[model samples]
Target: MAEQNRTSVAELVLEGLSERAEVKAALFVLLLLIYTLTLLGNMGIIVVIWGDPQLHTSMYFFLGSLSMVDICFSSVTAPRTLVNFLLERKTISFTGCMGQAFFYTVFVTTGCFLLAVMAYDWYVAICNPLLYSSVMTHRLCIWLVVGSYIGGVLNSIIQVTFIIRLPFRSSNVINHFFCDVPLLLALSCASTYINSMILFSMAGVIELSTISTILISYIFICFAMLRIRSSEGRQKAFSTCVSHLTAVTMLRRTTIFIYLRPSSSYSPNTDKVVSIFYTLVIPMLNPLIYSLRNQEVKSALRRTAERITVRL
Candidate 1:
């Protein structure tokens, strides 16, 4: 009976952003444009950092890692979504949905932790300038990046395990654009009390702690900047952190809203809009956020362009 209940729904119908033919076409075109730009923007950052020897620092290294994450994390869902928008019958196999859920969880978790690590790096650079070189060694940065990935995968595995075990019944229509924890939990016929407890309690704690660390680091950074006597010196000090500050604010706002809440409170309509922001809009905007206001990145891009022209 238990096994029968689980196999009842093998493929899920994705009720995406719209149902009208005209709306689907518009959405497809718009998303395609955004997705193309997202790829170019993020890959452009990675390539620029790689080609420019001047950017071979702990800060740029982390930035490059972040670009990679944005690219990959966006890729996991965007392509499938684009495909579904065009298809008459929007369906994903159970296995594919599970895989999507897992990867989505992993990349999102990794991105959050990476932001926290970057915050710590900024704190070290600003607050402890003299010790920055000694503390944020190349070895340590690599470990931090690697550890974030490992931690994300581990967390995804645990969460996906809990979710996959729950028996989904006759209701196979996922109201959102993609398969996510909240939507999946809503679909499950089995008792999701334990799942809700873990998601709200465990996930909430992690998000809260990460945000607290970021806040504390920025507090110390503000104090450090205030200590600078010269206006020029203070501005210079603050410039180094502005891009990161913006990125953190954008990522944390949508993430905290989506994850740190009770399952019962999750309205599919509101959650889907938030999902589009973090998964699609944020990834598209991240590279622009980092590069547009950044002089170093602008200079590196110019140098990279000159080198490419020379090669041509």
Candidate 2:
């Protein structure tokens, strides 16, 4: 009976961001612009890093990997969202909904690990300059990236497996623009205590672990900076960290707010607003934050642009 109930719903309806005609029109244009910029900005970062020999270092390699992940992360939701704005009845098949949730979890989890690894990279580079080269070798960087993706896959499989087992026999309507685990869990007819516990516990663990890594790395980075006598030297060291700190704070806060609590406490309106920020806004901002703040990235962009112009 439970299995039959689960398979009964062939399609789920998405109650997207807005319903009004004017609002949908405005959102379509605004979201289209943001999505375009996200692709262009992230893709630019990857291309610049790949083409420039000067950026052939551990730091830029991680930045490139991050850019690629951001592209995937935003792509998982943004395109569907744009399409839904045009359609009167915004709907997704059961399989498509689950697929979105799966990939969304994978990229988001991978992104968190990447940020944590990047924090550690900064720690090594700033705290142990002499050993940075030896410590963060190309082989080690590649393994770190591969491990992040693997961890994401494992986590996603577990979470989605739990969701798949539940019989969503009540409402086929999801409150947000995209399919999220918490929202999906809310739609199930069966008692979601186990599912909620798993979601909260896993989210808590991931958040606690990753945030701790970032905090500890920054603490060490702070001490290392203070050890430098000159104010100019200290400032230079601190500047490199600003971009990463901004990105981490934004991503962590939004994710924790959404996932670390019981689904009963969820406010549909508030969740939609926050989801838009992290899903659409943050990916758009990351490359801009990194490139605008980093002089090395700026120089590399200029070099890449000049080479392109020459070819043209």
Candidate 3:
């Protein structure tokens, strides 16, 4: 009976970001612009990092991996969102919804781990400059990235497996633009205590572990910077870390707000607004944040542009 009920709901309707016609139209245009910029900005970073020998370091490798993840992460929902804005009935099939949730979890979790890895990279670079080259080798960088994806895939499989087994009997209307675990949990017919516990525990573990890594890395970095007697040296070390700190704060706060709590406390409207920032806006902002603050990236971009102009 539970299995039958679970399979009964073939499709689910999404409430999306807005209901009013004018709002939808405006958001459609706005999201389109943001999505375009996200692709261009992230892709531009990847290309610049790849083409420039100056950026052939562990730091830039991680940055390139992050750009690729942002592209995948945003793509999980952005196109469907744009399409839904045109359609009267915003619906997703059960398979599609689960798939979206699964991939979204995978990419987002991977991104969190990657950020932690990058934080560790910064720690090594700033705290142990002499050993940075030896510590963060190309092989080690590749393994770290692969491990992040592995962790993401494992978490996603567990979470989505439990979610897919849930019997969503009646309510097929999800209260957000995309399929999220909390919203989906609310739609299930059976008691979601186990599911909620699993969600909170899994999310908590990821958040706690990653954030702890970042915090500890920064703490060591701070100590290392303090030992440097020169103000200029301290400032240079701080500059390297500030951009990553900004991104971590932005992403961690929203994710903790959404996932590390009970589903009963979820505010649909608030979640939707926050989701927009992380999902659509953050990807667009990451490259800008990194590139604008980074002189090396700026130099690379300038050189790349000059080369392109010469070719043209």
Candidate 4:
């Protein structure tokens, strides 16, 4: 820990949140409940999907991937933030902040890529129905997942590199709950033009491009829906897209709100509010948005329950 910071610094003090005893206790309770909810919701999605062999298709496979990502994404910040809220000192050392930023970078980037892949999967399924099975076969699905991981790694490397190289000279009170890219960069005494450029470029490629792909895919889906003669098919198709649309909306809104500015011009207060949405609320909502309204998931759960009851 000491080795990570400058040699002149003797002790790394954590400058956390307020000193009010009541406020700290309240925050701890609220955040602890949210954190628990996040874990249960995401893990439940993964468990149900894995347990239901009927969900072994590409769609559910990606859904399981999404659930895993949500779990990791929320876990990266919420637990630590909850701990910080409970403790008297909320401050994280230089290394700890950097490490948090690093994992956050990885999971966040993975989410961006994963959403794009899911969009592509839907595009293939709807746009080319005859070839859907062949196109989205096990091999292709594996490749898409691999692409997501690769994109996440590459993006995280870029963001972390810029953040790591910057010099932070005192007044290290990060207004937010966690060590986000912009908040950390704001502490740098030196100019952050290089870092800002890298952050913007990375955000542009990963966030913007992925979102655009989702919109375009949905546009085509909409067109196809208009042409469907069967009412049942239309309703089912629309329902399939509704979940994807909801998830995409949540991800994109929070992402754009947070990363749409240069670090030099970012507001920590705005960042903190939006960060809570994406980092905490959004992860908790993923399973509900995707699984709650889906009849297949509900049916599978019932079947599993009866099977367990009979065995017992």
Candidate 5:
């Protein structure tokens, strides 16, 4: 009977970001612009890194990977959101919702690991300059990225397995713009105590672990920067890490706020807003922040532009 109940609901309705038609239209336009910029900005970074041999270092390699992940991460939710704004029904099949949750979790978890890896890259470059090239060899970087994806996939499989086992018979209306763990758990008729425990434990293992690595790496980086005799060298060393630090802070704060807590305290309104910032705003901001702030990226862009002009 419980199994029958779970299988009965073929589709679920999404109570999206807003109820008002005007607000929906406005949000649709705003998010469309943000999504467009996110694609262009991240794609531009990838292009610049690929075209400029000078930018083909470990740092830029990681940055390129980060941009690619950002693009995938944002797309996981944004297109559905835009479509939801235009549709009156705002409905998704049960399988569709689960797939959405699964992919979002994978991309987000992968991103966390990627950020931590980037921090380690900075630590090696600053503290162990002599070993940076060997430590962050192309093969190692590739494996690190592949390992991050594997970790994310494993995490997603665990979470989604638990989710699919629960009977979602209470209600099918999710109170956010898209499918998320907390929102989906709320729709389950079965007790989600174990599910919540798993989420908390995963958060501890994934978020806390990655955050600790980043913090420790930065500590070493700061110590190394302090050892630099020249003020200009210190400033330059610090500048390279600023953008990554900013991105890490932005991602960590909102993610911890949303996922690390007990579901009993889940506030849909606040969570939805924070989700917008991380899912929509951050992707658009990351590329612009890195490109505008990094000297190497700016120089590469200038060179790429000059080449295009000469070609014409």
Candidate 6:
């Protein structure tokens, strides 16, 4: 621990991406391009979904929620990184740091659970097409999304509780972009055993349970596909899972990388680099993945554009 814990944290220094100015400048330009692309891509998803009414199905509903979350998730961290690139003073208040940590956790966790629900949705849709309409009713969809939000809030509360209990007498500098649990815990001056335990337990529950459920659902889907006699049927069924799988794999893999580590081994620098995936890249990739791959979305976009062009 540092000798003196000051009453006022005059400045929250960034022990930035190394001491070399050249490296920082390079990171700046690269991240700025990614940040801009993230915003535009996610915004495009929301716009395209909103403009098209046929996309009001449960799947698209989930897709819209995902876009909204990705937007919020990216906003929570990217702006700070962009600002750090340009600003002379690279500091965030203690309260602000906590705020970013809270929201980031909320959105990311919610997105994770929601993605699991999406996998299950695909399962129900393909495995039981006859019953899909009944099983995935408006009420059921609402409940599933609500459940995701509830679960995320509880998860965030547990993580945030761990963060609040830790003593920060050692260092005020939070390396990387935002306040994340693993990194923040590393800086704490207290015994973070309890917090680390809770974090691990939560990760096991959220990540393991969700991933297991999705995997099982896909297993059943695959089995059902195998039984189908027609080649077209198998291809069509597998296509349904592809986009969801892409999104889930992108998020779950990276989250496991970041959260599954011990506090002692947590690296703020590495966290920042990978954090860009979930925070910026995945969100942008999702809409594009779903939209471009699906004929319906592309056709809808074309028709919508045609209508506008005709009116003009």
User: Across residues 37-105, which tens digit of lDDT does each residue of candidate 5 receive?
Assistant: 999999999999999999989899989999999999999999999998888899999999999999999
Q: Write the per-residue lDDT of candidate 1 for residues 20-119, one digit (tens) a residue.
A: 8998899899889988999999999999998899999898999999989999999998999999987888899988998999999899989988998999
Question: How many Å off is the CA of 190 in candidate 1?
Answer: 1.2
Question: Over 4 Å off in model 1, which ranges?
Answer: 1-7
Candidate 5 minimal-lDDT segment of 10 residues:
1-10
TM-score of candidate 3 on Cα atoms, chains taken together: 0.97
Q: What TM-score, over all chains together, does every model reach?
A: 0.96, 0.97, 0.97, 0.91, 0.97, 0.91
* C-alpha-based local distance difference test score of model 5: 0.90
lDDT of 2 at 234: 80
Please report how far candidate 6 places residue 172 from its true position, in Å.
0.5
Summed over model 6, clashes come to 0
lDDT string for model 2 (110-154, tens) is: 999999999999999999999999999999999999999998998
- Worst ten-residue run, lDDT, model 4? 6-15
Candidate 3 C-alpha lDDT tens digits along 1-312: 767756589899998999899999999999999999999999999999999999999999999999999999999999999999999999999999999999999999999999999999999998899999999999999999999999999999999899888888788999899997778888988888998899889999999899999999999998998899989878767777888998899999889888876656778899889999999899999998898878899999999999999999
| lDDT of candidate 4 over 56-168, digit per residue (tens) | 88988998898898888889888887777667666677777777888888888888888888888877777788988988999888888888888887877788777766656
> How many pairs in model 4 have backbone atoms within 3 A of each other, for residues 3 or more apart or on separate chains, i.e. clashes?
4
Q: Candidate 6, residues 175-260: lDDT per residue as tens digits?
A: 77677777677777778888889888898889888999899999998888888889987776777678889888899889988888
Instruction: Judging by lDDT, tell me the better candidate of 4 and 6.
Output: 6
- Ten-residue region with minimum lDDT total, candidate 1: 260-269
Task: Give the candidate order by descending lDDT.
Answer: 3, 2, 5, 1, 6, 4
Query: Which residue pairs come into collision in candidate 3?
Result: none
